[model samples]
Target: MDLSFLSEQVLWGISVGQLIVAAVLPLLGFLAQSVVRRLLRRVMSRLRKEGDLSVVDDVNRLLTRPLSFLINVALWNGVIGLLDLPEEPLSIHSWATTLGMVALILVIAYCAFHVVDVFAGIATRAAEKTETKLDDQLVAPVTNTVKLLVALIMVAAILGQFGYSATGLIASLSIGGLAVAFAAKDTLANIFGSIVIFSERPFQIGDIVEISGVEGAVEEVGIRSTRIRQFDQTVSILPNQTFTNVEVRNLSKRESRRVRFEVTLTHEATVAQLEDFLDSIRHSLAQRTDLHPDQSMVRLTKLDTNGLGVLVQAFTISTDFAEFMVTQEEILLRVRRLAEEQELPIMPAKEVRLSGEVGEPRSS
Candidate 1:
């Protein structure tokens, strides 16, 4: 533990310079780091005043720690270079510089990733204001691709620092990628299907769509699959490729919902009663604000053995399911009141025969 022994021991064959410089370099590095941080704070303050707050905040948050480390490394590298060390095959200075360069590359890649994420958030916010969801869906994929590219570049730079060539690595990756594509052809097709979805935009998030006999509201459109929440509250995860293969009906895009059905009445009713019933229905429908004025019809469409089939076809102005149900209920109630007021017989006829006697037909 003697102080004189520390002075006698040489580090990398440097006896006098190692101990003195090690003690002084930390202090100098700290002072230089403090100055740089103060300058950065001032620059960030000015940026906040002139530029976007989010951009400035992101830059300050992502770069602050890496910049501090870089400044400290630079100061130490300069101090270490000043030492009078013996020539060796692998010196401490050379190792420190190499490590420093690699560390710098990693920090740069980290900052680039965060920057991409911030920009993606901004892009998503902008996309939300527009009606189409194509831009919104593209945000994640674009951000991830940018980050991957940045990471690949950083890897190449680091490899180059160690005197390794990235050409062979890239070629090997290309060949490996081809092999993977062949093995996972369906996965690639789904990915391409997602691209087609974003570009074509047949259906978007929250759209009520019917595809392959399944009807639901689109919850999320992901890269490989789309999530749909059914009317029964169950969720269905469909592959993106399914959308490309099948026809998708976007119910939400329909301007109005059609209501069509036949109301059967007893054949005992006279033609005058049938005419009055039809007239009453037309009058009621015309008075309704929910029904489309130009697309309503109430007419006797068929004469069956049991009764007359009165076709009531109309379109409601509302596309909402709940609203459509309410409008249909209102129309039915109005028809019921009209039939009751007019005293029109609405039951179907039945036939009966006597069993014991000579098969006489009778109405039961």
Candidate 2:
């Protein structure tokens, strides 16, 4: 088995036996890491199904690399010690130690990213329990901020490892950052705009808002931009700065959706028939729980060559677009039925169009 050559020195007075052990250590570490990950995945899967511990699943997935890196570093450090690397000439031992330290620092930073996710998970759960919705808007931006801070710190640590003064580096960055700020003034403004949104809170997440000539439910409020998921299923990422100065109409904040439509009947339709239709509509609207009882208005406001303009205005309790559309559908269908009951021709089927906002019509 060549056991006699096991004691022979390979380099730096290290025996072949020690070199073989050092090489085998990494292989063992790899096997151990794989076994540990498999066990963790199984355990996390159980925990995820049995309880509300979804965070464990995330930790298992995200921490694999950092954990594996840790094991590799530890094994290599042991290898370095076992080899008794020389201190003089190249300072290979010192260089290796320093490199390992930098690597450990990076791994720590990497782990810090998931640490933020853990806290964010906790915050999100807590937000769900709270009655106030403003807390929900903070989770994304704060999580992003902590991650950015972690990266910046990691860069500083790496700089210091190269014998650069951390304080001096920051001072230099402060000066350089000012120039960068000037150069990327728009970015800074957007960041500040985000701050304004957080502080002022003109509209919170999930609010159906019309802002900056765009209409949608606010999907996310990020550091530099606001994401609006439009009605057409497209997402518009507008600069945060765009919201700071523009008019923001929070449509969802309203108590009820304002619905206004003109139902035109034939010019030959009499005042008595129109009045009867209006009275019937008002009575029918009062019976519905979705509409505000006192607010329903059905008036014959116009008599022209075109037709008799029967203006129908009411406020629906629904704030959501789809729900409001359903309400509109029911009301329009009802109006048509009433016109048919009176044997009045509608000229053709009437159409409802969105002009200004949900249930709000544009001026003629």
Candidate 3:
């Protein structure tokens, strides 16, 4: 087989043409991007001059991502077209090409939408009067959910472009949903629970709370679980559903804690002395304006064989554990000093017995 059919002049011309096109395409690509960038700047400057910074900022950010993507895409297409593709015996399907183009367009639209969403999130947070990390918490889920929906729609559209049926896929998913539901029951419960928790706000991150005998400060409230940093320096992970179903005690909710305790006094105390002691305690407590005025209550409740049980109630202004402990100690110390000055002794239990109860007399 003598292959002298291909002439050198034709091959040389094709190579020269490819080289020239490659060198010129880059210059053209740069000019196009430069023109687009100038147009965007002019538009943004006009918006800013009109005192609509919000719109200007949005447009500025929106143009940047897509413009960069567009410029890169142009460069790529220019390079690809410049190459002298081989003339070989091959077949190409028009339908497949059309489907590919549609998918490409869909992907580009999705990316543009994603850029807009990011800018919107930033603008929303900046415009708010008050700041909260909850905004940060919500943005991820909202953005992801939107992206997922958009992607699903784009996929369906692309599939339809290829003559695939959306209804058939939906039916297949429905058929498989039962088993999937069974496998993901906990996840579903947690998702639903997160909704409830966010709406109700039983507890938030950084709040000291107690639930199911576990006491700790909430570290994070996630979509599926809540993490708490325990007092013992370990972390506890509880399912979000548990908080929805079980009782949660939020210590941060209460500004103060009411403390209850009982102290026994000697049964031998005279009524006058007891009255004096009670009056002293009341007076001492009344002097403490830091404590809730309505919270001070002391009473003689019961008389026991050992002593008189005196019930005492007081309030601490702060729910902080350390503060509560300090206030409690001070109150007890004051009570002790006052009792000592009044000579009221702490009651002590006693036992007495009689000699010669029943005995036969012996002859001496």
Best-fitting candidate, scored by lDDT? 2
**Weakest 10 consecutive residues of candidate 3 by summed lDDT:** 87-96
User: What digit string (tens of lDDT, one per residue) describes model 1 on residues 315-351?
Assistant: 9998999999988888777787888899887764466
Worst 10 residues of 1 by lDDT: 78-87
TM-score (C-alpha, index-matched) for candidate 2: 0.62
lDDT of 1: 0.82
lDDT string, candidate 3, 177-214, tens digits: 78888989999899888788777777766788999988
**Candidate 2 residue lDDT tens string, 278-333:** 98888888888998878888888888777778899999987777788999989989
TM-score for each candidate, following the candidate numbering: 0.79, 0.62, 0.72
What number of clashing residue pairs does each candidate have, in the order they appear?
A: 0, 0, 0
Residue 209 of candidate 2: its Cα lDDT? 92
Best by TM-score: 1
Model 2: clashing residue pairs? none
